[model samples]
Target: MHFRHQTLSSALAMMASLACLSPLQAQTTGAQAPVISQSDAQHLTAAPSKLTLLTLLEAAWSRQPEAQSYTERLRAAESLRAASSAWTADSPAMLLQGKTDRPGSGAGSREVEVGVALPLWLPGQSQRATALSHAQILALQGSMKAQRLQLAGLVREGWWQTQRTQTELALAQTRVANAQQIALDVARRVKAGDLARADQHQAEGAVAQAESAVAEAQGAYEASLHALRGLTGLLDLSPDNLEATSEGDVSTPLPSADALASDAPSVDEHPLFAEAMAQQSMASAQADLAASSRRASPELTVLTTRSRGQTGDPYQQSITVGLRVPFGTGARADARQAEALAAAQEAQAMTLQMRARLQAQAASALARLRSAHTQWQATHRQAQLAQESKNFFDKSFRLGETDLPTRLRIEQEAVQAQKALSRARIDVSAAWSAWWQALGELPKP
Candidate 1:
């Protein structure tokens, strides 16, 4: 009976010792921890150190059709500008005429004429055309910037989505590891007759739940990575190369609230607003050109005629000059003028609409950034309290003062708090990206 009493005391002491071991210490026993498959392990590798937001933006921009066509569009606009600077409104024409009267008079009588006609630009037409071409160039430039900013928004969205899923996956993996360690301890205790078989089953259930979460988080992470790769056209992107700072490591600080509030760029400086204004200017120039061009371009003709009155008469040559002025067709001119005027008015309205929309977007983005920062601070505090609670429960369970269910609940709460904290960090980064986007700025290196 004394020997049996000593054995029970030794078993109790062993259970107590195991219970005091922290999760990290328990994880050090390689053979007891559940094995993570190679595929899951690969997805959990450390982030690539060299990748940056600017690099992703450049990669995504390279794949865009608009980015490729920007140079061509600029060249076309320059050609229009060059054409507008020429002396003639249209190309010069060469005219020729010849006549013979040999059949009726039996006389060698003929006339030949050759002339050149030069089309003249109406007053101020060239200047207006030049102005229109300049406006087109400005509009193209603004449009390109706008397109790049739009693409930046997409990259930011994909990048942050990837970060969010990756954080979840990391947390899920940690949970799995912790649950597996607990299960191993519970199984040992059950075999030693210190814990019931039902407790072992409960521990195993927790492990299974954690593993299920890993599967779900893994799927989400892979999907987010694929979307980012599609946008960037980069097939070899590392899953862990995140733009946002990692948990517990803030190497790069977030923008301050004062900076965010005071550094709002002017709405007129935005590409969308500039593009709209350029369009309005171009339309106004078009209207002016149309108003000046009330009639077809007049032509000045210079000719040379060679003729003979009779068969015996010597051939004669003479030079002639004339002007050809076309009459103004009031109906056609009126229609064209009215169309140009309508386009100008429409462009004016659009510019006003664009300005208002950009201002609203900027305001919305600022609000979101502020809200995200507030949430991040709250989550940080919640995570700290949850961690403290978990530590308390961990010690209590080790001393036999707490049950398995209570300890598990505390662990879960801690994990949930950690998840919220990670999400909040990512949200703050994403909001800043969105704020830059709203201001028509691309992601900086």
Candidate 2:
């Protein structure tokens, strides 16, 4: 699987390089006709190039709002972390006061005071706050990783869907070419008076059917391509772009099912699991901080006062220091602590659920990959036998030993068998992609 995956990566890179060339360059090099229709080429040309898996993943990531906001989120977490390290629990405030008794005795009496109020952190609260900030950073990083993995799954699905449709289109085109050839042969036989006119009509009808199938396949292929382009913001309509080799075609021996089962990584390592764990840690830290913060922060006040009695009296300055301890609001603290604890418990439960889901997905994907391998082998044999049978029937038909209906039936069977083989090959690649997705692995460059 690894070898085949690398082969596919190389193929995609090569195709992307080719796609980067101008039409004039392609024409000068005498490139073959594009696999896609002219309309598709026109539509795709408007999109950016570089359609490799990694490029596609990047393009998709760039479009995500969360990805765009990640830097700001990180900055905010860092700011909180810095704040937690400060000596003061909150910002300091300045206080000013002035008093006069001019309306009363008229014997000038005035007082002016200035003060600074500094908030203090409760014991253990600062450390808990720092822990929460650290957890916030970890949680954000984990969330980003999980988000990228989710996007990788989307890209994988779109990539394989496009491959499947392209395969169908290619097979449909081949069927049309074969049908046209058969029609020509039937016409020749009719002209020589060796075959009836009805045979020619039947052959032409087959050609029409094949053409219709090609048209349908083309539409489906274009739609899938468009959807992929939407995700990756890239389009390379080159024929070689569809030539990625499937795992079934690789000569590398696959690992045994038991080996696959044992190769599964621990669920704790998964991005979703990590994100849930981080969230739980953050919530726990928050609960701890809340528990320590039983009341509003205590404030230390330092004041300087100047007073004068009568206009000629000289001012006096004195410094006074005082401490203000807020009364504890047990109900508010209880509510906040309860909320944080509840959040922690919820996050823990989510972590367990995420682990279970990942394990199940990994197991299911592995089983499907194994099944796809088996199916590919059977389909490969079926296609080979169908081809041989088609060859025999073609010879017998030309020799006037086989009826037109029998020849047509053989052709249909051959085409179906070829289609199945192509689909099976694509399925193998798709299964591998899905397995990687289940394991939270992104496509490598």
Cα lDDT tens digits for candidate 2, 278-375: 98898888888888998999999999999998877998899999999999998988898899889888888988898889888988888888888899
Tens digit per residue, CA lDDT, model 1, 122-156: 88988988988998898888888888888888888
The Cα RMSD of model 1 versus the native structure comes to 7.5
lDDT of each: 0.78, 0.78
CA deviation > 4 Å runs, candidate 2: 1-50, 103-107, 235-250
**Lowest summed-lDDT stretch of 10 residues in model 1?**
25-34
Number of the top TM-score candidate: 2
